[model samples]
Target chain A: MRKAYSSLESLRGLCGLRICLAGSRPFKREVNSVKSRAKRLGLNSLTFPRRMYLFAAPALALFLVFWVFPLIQMFFYSFTNFNGINFNYDFVGLKNFVNIFKDGTLGNSIRNTLVYTIVMVGASNLLGLAIALALNSNIRLKTLFRTCCYIPALFSAIVVGFIWSYVYMPRSGLLVSLITLVGGDASKLNILGNHKVALYGIALVEVWKGFGSTMIIYLAGLQTLDENLLEAARIDGCNEWQLMRLVKLPLISATITINVILSAIGGLKAFDYAFIMTSGGPGKATNTLMFNVYRIAFNEQLMGKASALSVISFFCIIIVTVLMLYVMNKREVEL
Target chain B: MRKFRLKPQSVLLHAFLLCFCVLIIYPLLIVLSSSLRPPGNMDSPLLLFNQFSFASYIRAFEKMQYPKALLNSILTSGASVLVIVLFSSMAAYPVSRIKSKTSRFLYYFFIAGLIVPSQMVVVPVAQMIGRLSIPNNRFTPMIMFITCSLPFSTFLYAGFMKSVPVEIEESAYIDGAGLWTRFAWFVLPLLKPATVSVAITQGMWIWNDYFYPMIFVTRRDQFSIPVVMLQFLGDRENPAQWNILFAACVLCALPLIAVFAVMQKQFVTGIAAGAVKG
Candidate 1:
């Protein structure tokens, strides 16, 4: 993405030029309209330049209303004991937040989400890196392989979840049938029924659906590798495994960090597979933070707690993301 | 000399990859097979092309209100693509072209939306939409689709625009072309690839997206395909209606996959470049 348009660039000489025509007008201006008239005329007059804000008004309106406003409402409502449908609710004063801590499912949900994140992020990136390495080799029909690898990702997460539910559908499911075919006597297997395995089972599908994109990203990153470096390492008597560990791995550390961070964030907020595969399970085994937020808000009608959860989730996501980015940035070698 | 296929490494790689491909495509094959079968709990894991039929597809289409749902999805996603492309492209102009102190600040301000973890905002957005008395409306999600999509779209457009030299617009200015004219005639044509990338990326996103639609769209008729499919998958009128449900799943996925097939490279390239979503 950092590489600028190579062959596909259509624009000739329009970007970096001084957009202000010579001797036309200064780009910035200090307007001196009457103060009250300026107030009546609006804040736009005092702020952004006409053309720039004209270009940005629609998007900013949307950004303010849909994204920014709701977030404020979410925070304020989190402090209240508000039911979802009505405007009548007293200020609960951390009651909802306290209840969240006391709520057993909250702890369970957080743990399950962490477990899901760890397994999904770990398994998918490792598997994705492996497949990327395999496809990165000199091979026939590489495009076909790439497409096939990515087809699962093309399906909606809901659809993928539904399809995998069929795959894990106890005795008659494809997975069970496959196991039975190998004389494993797994016909009565109920992967989604057992709380112990259900989270991981759902995580499996998430990994399955997600790894293709990870592979594609890795593949693209691999293409950017300096081949002479690899050849030099080989000439230094590095074997295939040594070359991978010493040359390929460290060189692709940037890609590794990127893929890990993305998949980790994805895993932390994973809802579709958990919700669809087991309906948050035979128990609340797969109840992720997002899914629990949905359940509380819509199902249980505890909008206050849900709003609190959403606020917590927002901060949790931001803090973790920033920390990961900071740590990764610190660790990234200049090479 | 031994044939190239005789290499142990090549054999191992091919075997691993072929098996991997089958695993990946197997559930898809099951969907295809089940969509062809009569309403039944399919027990077999083996794929049977000989049993293929479209009877389930025909019934599944009606049961899921496939046509209406499809139209809703198309209208919403198509509108999202157009809105994002237009606003973001227009917005990209002043941000990229005009070198000023505020432009950098504006760029970061807009791009900050990308970090807000959109799913977190769903709670209040749903309630706010309800308060606005437009709950269950398509246009509400349209606002969301645009808002959530803008940061990346604007980023991409601005990035692409940076490669475009400012001389062309200046030349157009010399010829007495107004801003909108330069934008419409000269600038938009120059933004062809960026526009398509945004359209393809955001369009697919809005189409495949189920969460927002599931929350906002309450009526059966208004439900997008994914939302409707989820509703029905839970209710299944008959226990043996797995085939029809699978058929619905297939139908829901087919159009996007078709879109993917035609614009495979763009879809992949857009995703790899943008990383729009967390």
Candidate 2:
């Protein structure tokens, strides 16, 4: 015991000396490494018992049984003619995929999903960044305003979708009421009912419920911007716009990447608004990929085809996300 | 005159922010006011409180079976978050501490789950649930919630676990403390912030999620808050029971909003920590 105490004391003294000699973080990390190495030499212990793996067993079992196994089964089921009811099903070998494409469902849903993603990514980021900038400034009631902004985000998508549906209701909706009160023609203002406008309308609801989170993230990023750096930029006679364009945007490029990619991924999985508000409605105009999968699987009872569509969606999401991350990372480095 | 001399840019910024806040808050206020008015009264949306009453709340409360649904929501979300926090934190302990290729691979394996959208697996999950003869109960969605949340929560706890210095655990180990005791007493307490993050994020999601429950639990009694609120959707009998629908919406949102009111700072911090760090 005395020997162990002496060894630990010596190691602490060594770490102290190293900190005094080189005050850098990496240097300090090296000191920690040396101390840990000393521990590995048996002054203390570092062995994770085999039983520690049991700590991971519950989650792993759950993941394998519920998530991974299901995913694998989905890929397999996609190749077969399983209608979700019968046990006897044959492997069709790409026929389900071919059917989706041949039926125009794939093209329409993909187009809608892409458009919805684009709208969400554009609108949410812009609005969020704007609000984040405004809130980050020396504004009165800032917390109150921020909380109010986030109120919509706190509500479930069902509530948001329901409220927005009512807000966009045809004649006596809040929107139409406001437009009429402002003396605009409100006769033909049906957002959720119009095939061309339904997708955008639901996308707008998502934006409303979503931008607050984006703003919160952007605010967190902006708060990390060095005060001295901003002051230096201002001291260099840069105007507000120039400072924002030249310094702030570049500084928060990483945050922008995170926000944009998150929004895009979120937008790609757009189902709640479509499911609740429009029900992929107004003649399948708002048929997002996720909603389409739901419709195919449950409504049409074509689980095999839906599985195929899900596989396609899985690949599509992975590809789009990877591409976005790549492009955003490139822009981040350039900025 | 000096006191009134606000900068033009500052004024413009405030004005823009104020208008934006109004735009965001007005719709919510409309819902609130519509709920306050008597049922079957379709007044102008412009009216705030021409006649205030809780009649709609009473009606919505009964119709949506708010008590039962709220209990189911509370049970599923609360229990799922508890188990998720425990399991993920435990799982992260080994992944974060043990230095091995397997550990590294396991870490990335869980992280990869963040990219795979849950909808991709829903079809098979449904089929599996059916084949397994899983009952449409609260635990069904609870299990699904736990499974889905594992990856993110594990990643989060693992990130935080790295920040916890190993020396303490080593010292505890040297003091003849076993792994379970050390983890439960020392490491787990230190991971409280991570636990809270996992809880809040996963709790909010499980509480608000209707999709999984909508798919898994078809029974009316087993329905969660959001799923139960679906009754108000397209109610063809009344055609325009806006008051009851809006009232139900408010009730569905009230619990979370109430929690947010108390723990606003934590909510923001939780989100920021998850997003920025993760």
Candidate 3:
């Protein structure tokens, strides 16, 4: 038995040696055959393993169940008179949409949301760009100023809104106190209470909390500007204003696009301040798209109406986003 | 020695920035100071560091159920972020690796969620939550957060995953390493930067978002920090106690501010990186 085992082991070793002597070229040929075979069979084992797709199944399942399904159901509900409490509701068709339009809710919220987006996109960009320019330059205490400026952005909207409501409070508010300190008459400074100024008031609060982040993005983009190019421009007799307008603006167009789109989207979702500070009040003066949705859905118990409103806003948002992206991309390419 | 001379332009820039900083910071300082004043001191002067009392803190703490809300906030947001990172990276892997029609469809499918804001679908989602009898608890809000975050998180992960060479993964696969093993060992470690971006940005949103919790969580004790602060909103019947409300705001914002103070570089860089990349 021992002799047979030794002879078997030697035979195996001889086979291994023979295979090694001949294996290298055949191995390459075999791999190439496998590759060609896989290609012919439309089976890309290297890239498209059937087993690999299983990794995405969990997230995809969650996405479909939680996100896609809900959105589809939202569309369905927009057509029915589902009052949120009852499961047995009738199809109302276009009635909800017509009702919202006739009552002026749609037009009012759209106008207010547009105004808010304009203010946010305008004020946030200008202030953020200016701050970014100043901070990007050679300045003292750069980190300290940046951090302090960003502190408000760190706080929750609830906190920021609450604080600002107090600031905009009547004679006892901080704005009044500041004006008094500066020797200005401060009697008629009820910003949040006045219907004409209420929307602007909340929009400014949005800007205050948002501009820091916008500034940071602008600063990042500004840092990428070539210092040598600026120096060369300076050598060619470009003033600071000329340098900024001519050299800096064109280079950072991408960042401006990003900030504008972000602030626009954020402004369109203006609910928290209107909800917290104004309660969509001063006679629906600050009733934004989102707050109107909340008011109709929760307070009025009109889920169908709210869903219709949401569908309108959804189309509005998607169109606005696509349009902005197209226009901005064109502008960026042109620049 | 060089003469210490301030250039006029530099001086003007500094002065303007100083006023801007003051404008940004003074309101927060007012909240801080008002929170420290004695309870019922609504008429207290808006000066910094004038009072040394925690009376409002104590009152607000009890009123807002500080300990419970803080624990809920930490647990929910932390769990949501952990799962968001894991699920999103896994989902992004195939989308990035495979070159097929299905993969392309899935990539755009996830990216489509970016434009459709969650509030647009809140009605049906809320109804589905009720109809399905999902328990309105802290974890419920976590599910909402994770679901809402997956779009951007997956977008981020997919962008990062394209940069990862397939050679490493293929080699590992040929070496008899299984899919999960290769992913855990090879892909995840290399994805540390994207992971940090995901964690910081999504973590900040989940932590600060009161909207989801306000909609989903019905139990008072299950309220997150921002929702708990909502309790201080005074209606006509009950006037807002300004001091206590300010105190609650401070308490609510304290943890994030502390984390930011420590991880300022990470927070700033992570957000900027995510924004730029996305």
Candidate 4:
């Protein structure tokens, strides 16, 4: 059994190993397959401007009906105290919005959400930059390293939350077991149970899952960089750190901005991890605004308050995006 | 010429990268280990694969109606991708080729949707979805997915379409090719990469998305993977059969993992390009 388990571990880790081994050899074949499949399907090829309009109309109608109508509907619903079950709803002017300040869970959720966003964004970006730079150097098995790192981002956030909850589980979890092995009495320390530590614990998982995609974006930006500028900087005796600070950093500012806005919006509206792992538990430590939206709507059945919260959050997302873009645009040094 | 050599610096760099990669991959493996362990006291949290059994998987598979959930997720994601690719590509063509003020305005209008996070709509959308009499079929979520994805797809398709030379389409027009033939034969093939990009990005989004289906999919039996798998975690058998939970997790993630492994290059490129707008 021990032998078998050991072999499984070896084989499992080597999953990426086999993929890396084959990554370079099968490129043309995959493209050919896609091409052959696409080539066989040439139905109803239209080119006129009017035809273009015709083709685009269905998607537009879906957009108008599903997306636009929903936004308008939600806006009006926020002004009323509507339960999900009712046709009749009374307009309680500013009452739901007034309730926002008095709600006990509201402040904690906002603070927890900010902490999650700031910490996850900072840690993930830093880690992403480091890995991207390391792999950009003369590293062997780059494909394997990248593939392994990026595996997490491909997963749904709920899956990530579920997996990390197991990692943070006490007594029988990986962290506690490791701590116990290292001769520390860490069994008593419940990372997810302690209200103070729970949010950051989830944040750490977010970083771990998210940083890989950040690195990929950075790598893409790095690869597209003008080599001449880099070589010229190298000739000017700018060392690695200096080179990165001066040229590489400035060059990838757009990518950095994109990642920042994405991570910020992602963190602000985070629901899956809090919902799956903690369910905003240990006295509202991990409850994000988005999670509270779910709680208010479904569990508490305060449909109106939920709509109000969503409207507030929508504005928050927009304001943060605009501010971020402004700040990032200022720093951007277009070469 | 300097012969290529793994210097001390390179060695340290490789060490750091290897450690990071292991840290990233290890948690996922541990879940697989726990899932395979016999259903008993959750001991040996760091257990690699000892006492591995398929019982948890069997239990999870039966309880979650695994095959049906898988089929439902696949159907929804596939239909969403097809609708998105066909329509968004067509939408982008006019916007890309025409270069009119209306087209340019339309482009930014689609881009405008990015700022409006779907969270705002969830409440009313849920309420509205409640009223709608769509069959409990996957169509509701599929339509929602299509509507949500179009802006991003159209954005990406328009961007890529700009790079496609116009002379070919113009000559095809001059060669007496009908508008449909020219578009189908001439333009569509040229837009294949964008199609692939849109398909992949939207496919992953629809497949992995939980929020939409949770609101729209009312029936337990008709649930998608994320919604159904969530049942295993919720108020269930009071003992919290975690081995079964972990098994469901593995099963839920396997299809996506397989997709990523197969199309790593296109998926990465497509996602990176898509992320620029975010």
Q: State which candidate, 2 or 4, has the greater DockQ.
A: 2
Q: Kindly list the per-residue Cα lDDT of model 3 for residues A149-210, writing each as its tens digit.
A: 78888889888888888888887788998888888999988898899999999999999999
For every candidate in turn, the CA RMSD to the true structure comes to: 9.2, 6.8, 10.2, 16.0
True contact recovery of candidate 1: 0.53
Q: What is the lDDT of residue A37 in candidate 2?
A: 86
lDDT of 1 by residue, B172-253 (tens): 8779877788778987898777877788767876888888887777678887888777865664434477888888889999
lDDT per residue for candidate 2 within A175-250, as digits (tens), equals 9999999899997999989999899999999999999999999999999999999999999999988998999999
Better of 2 and 4 by lDDT: 2
Candidate 3 C-alpha lDDT tens digits along B192-259: 88999999989987899999999888899889999988777772122247888888889999999999
Q: For each candidate, what TM-score against the reference?
A: 0.86, 0.91, 0.91, 0.88
Model 1, span A4-123: residue lDDT tens: 664234333343233443322343332333544565665443122356557877887888888889989889999998887788899998989889889776688778888998999899
Kindly report the docking quality category of candidate 3. Answer: medium
Worst 10 residues of 3 chain A by lDDT: A43-52
Could you tell me the lDDT of residue B116 within candidate 4?
Answer: 73
Q: TM-score of model 3's chain A, to 2 decimals? A: 0.86
Each prediction's Cα lDDT score? 0.80, 0.88, 0.87, 0.80
* Residue pairs in collision within model 4: A45-B180, A45-B184, A46-B180, A47-B179
Kindly state the number of residue pairs that clash in model 3. 0
The positional error of residue A177 in candidate 3, measured at the CA in angstroms, is 1.8
- Distance from true location, Cα of B13 in model 3, Å: 0.8
